[model samples]
Target: MNRDIAIMVDLQKLWDRKVEFEDGISHHEKSIAFWEKKISDIRKDVSVLKENLTQAELEIRLKEKKVYELEEKLGKLQKRRDVIKTEKELAALENEIKAVETEKDEIETVVIEEMESAAGIKKSIEKKENELAEAEPKMHEDIAYLRSKIENYAKEVRELISQFNAGLSKLSPEIKSRFEKTIKSKEGKAIAPLEGETCGVCHTSIPVHIVLEASSGIKAMNCTNCGRFIYKKENV
Candidate 1:
């Protein structure tokens, strides 16, 4: 291939490498983001579990306090029962005692249920804590590795860009200008190969003479339809 076309091809290769590095960086960044979100979600779950446990404990305490009050009332009523002289008074005392005992039983049942719920909550909290403990380190390691990969990709991108610029500088000003314009217009691809009589990029048919010229590698040409610089694959 002509020197200018060869330079353009090399420049395109450099551009591809730079894009590859940038893509790698992007992929790693996305992975880091995903892990960050997962960590945040886990932490939120742990917080909610802790809140639930606290609420359950509070309810248990309140129910136990009610039970204590009922028991105290029942004790006082039983002590007073012996002093009652009338059958009616004794019957009233017994009914009062019975009522107090019943209330106490109900409250005790509630407290027991609440205690059971609290125990379950504690177990769940422990499980979640363990999960967080295990996941946190792995998440950190993953993020660190991804960041390191992105840093390396950044360096590779810089090197590729430097190489592309150096290769571009070696071309004639006219060729450089044309290459730049063509790259911009052709979505970063300034050059393509001819296959048979077809432009590789635009798939347009090339005239016999232009195909012959491009195949000869004596000169660099553009696809008549797409205007991308064209060369023969064998020549490139």
Candidate 2:
């Protein structure tokens, strides 16, 4: 099998670059979406408040209609009192008028309270809508900026891949294939440099005989601990 340290290094570098670009793009998109969701929530709140105000206004109108009906009935009762022939009939009519007036007074109080509530709700709705309107433009700008950054990052990642491929082509075909297999299995990390007779990739001591074999470069060697191909660097 081909075991080329240079090819492995390039592949590892490319993998790191790809991961960095992917993570950056993901973070940027998430931030953009988060802001948009906040804006949407604000808009929804405004709509709910508007609906509440409308309902309150409708309730007040109904109450006012009831008050008008009460006034008309009270007027008719008063007229009857002037022309009534029986004392018992007049007393009943007066009692009815008093009861109607009391009910109307209670309803009017409720109507006033509802009017105030409706005004407050309308104000709240307007405030939230204005906030959302101001925020929407900022959100759009943020999303556009993120998209631009992602585009640039993708270009960088592509350039890195091209460089990595060029580095691999310099290796012997057999070595290239072997390194590709090992690196793929180990997640783009292969051909680790030996440190003080220890496998740097696996952090395990290499046998004296194996260390000598790696130095000679007659055959490929791997770390017994992690099974990654080993390369010996000349200097520290």
Candidate 3:
């Protein structure tokens, strides 16, 4: 085969391999992104937990203050019991004090329930924080590892591209330009090996004259149907 045609074959193979290597790089990039998103979500969840804890604490403080106020009110009502001058007045004072006591008891119950809720929330926060402390570092390590793999794949692609460009450099400018254009138009495939008297890719019958020239390796020709360069390899 002509040296230029041989180089084209080699360049074609290089281009295909380059695509595969780039795909590897792409895979790693996607994995890195996934890890990053997962970490972000975890942090967001932790932040939301913190906000809820703050709100719960504030609520508990408010309820406790209400209970204190009710107790003070009950104490003053009890002191009024000592000053009662009649049986009817004494009975009315006792009923009023009982109402105050009931209200205070209900408020205290809510305060205890809220304190329990706050405790549970605190425990959840602690658990999640511990998980984050451990998982965040591991996630970062995984992302770093994936990034390194991408770097390696990128380096390999760069080298393969250099080799492919070297093969193109060996061709005449016209042939090189033609190959570049065709490869782009054909999605990275610009040449096909001849299949007997037909185009290997499109299977279009080659004119006898064109086939003879191609088989002789005297010149290069394109298949009219598929528009790819046709080359014949020697029988090995």
Candidate 4:
């Protein structure tokens, strides 16, 4: 019932609520982190697909160039027929042309296959990008909501801290120091009401004199067993 103990009890209740809000903030932060990881994974997949498309495009270009060179070689070989001086020479030139044509056909086939593959890769990339574009906004919206919740919790904690400081400043230096020590030792709880003759924290019996001093409403006292500041409540 002492003024100093009353102030500390109020601060302790506010601190208790702050702890709960801090827990809420942590929960929201974890959810945001989860969404952020998903976004990162999606972008990573897109990047890998793009790299694959690049490689496929490069290979297709090389195959097409090879086909072109083979065509040129076949055309030159055909022109050699005009200058052939023997049937043997004609046969040799025909064989050379056939070989060049065969090689060109094989390369062209590969080029077509690679072009299809590249097209498929491009389609995959587009689909993933589209998915990201659509889903990213929703993800961001969810994150924003989570952040807003955290902001609200943080704001409450800040206000509680401000009010708690104001209340704490009203106490004498000795009481303030004792409250800080007990709050730290007990993790933000510095006072407990007497439960009959029992210590509310440790459930130990209160000594006759300590209980008398605390219940007098003149001074606050500590539990002999658990070292927590003890108080007696007046009827509301």
RMSD vs true structure, all candidates: 3.0, 3.6, 3.5, 4.4
Model 4 per-residue lDDT tens digits across residues 1-236:
67788887787888788888988999999999999998898899999999999999999888888888888888788888999999999998898888888888888888889889989988998998998999899998999999999999999999988987888889878888888777767366688788888887788998888888888878878988887888887893
Candidate 2's TM-score reads: 0.78
Off by over 4 Å in 3: 86-95, 182-186, 193-226, 230-236
Which parts of model 4 have CA positions greater than 4 angstroms off?
Answer: 1-3, 86-95, 181-236
Q: For this target, which candidate reaches the highest TM-score against the unseen true structure?
A: 1
lDDT per residue as tens, model 2, 162-216: 7777877887786777766766673567677788789877789989898888766
- Find the candidate with the highest lDDT and give its number: 4
lDDT of each: 0.85, 0.80, 0.85, 0.86
RMSD of 3: 3.5
Distance from true location, Cα of 194 in model 2, Å: 5.9
Ranked by lDDT, top first: 4, 1, 3, 2
Total residue pair clashes for candidate 2: 2
Model 3: per-residue Cα lDDT over 1-236, one tens digit each: 78778888888889889888988988888888888887788788879888988998898888888888988988898999889899999999999989988988898888888888888878888887888888888988898888888888899999998998788889877688989888767367888788888988788898988888888876778887888888897773
lDDT comparison, 1 vs 3, better candidate: 1
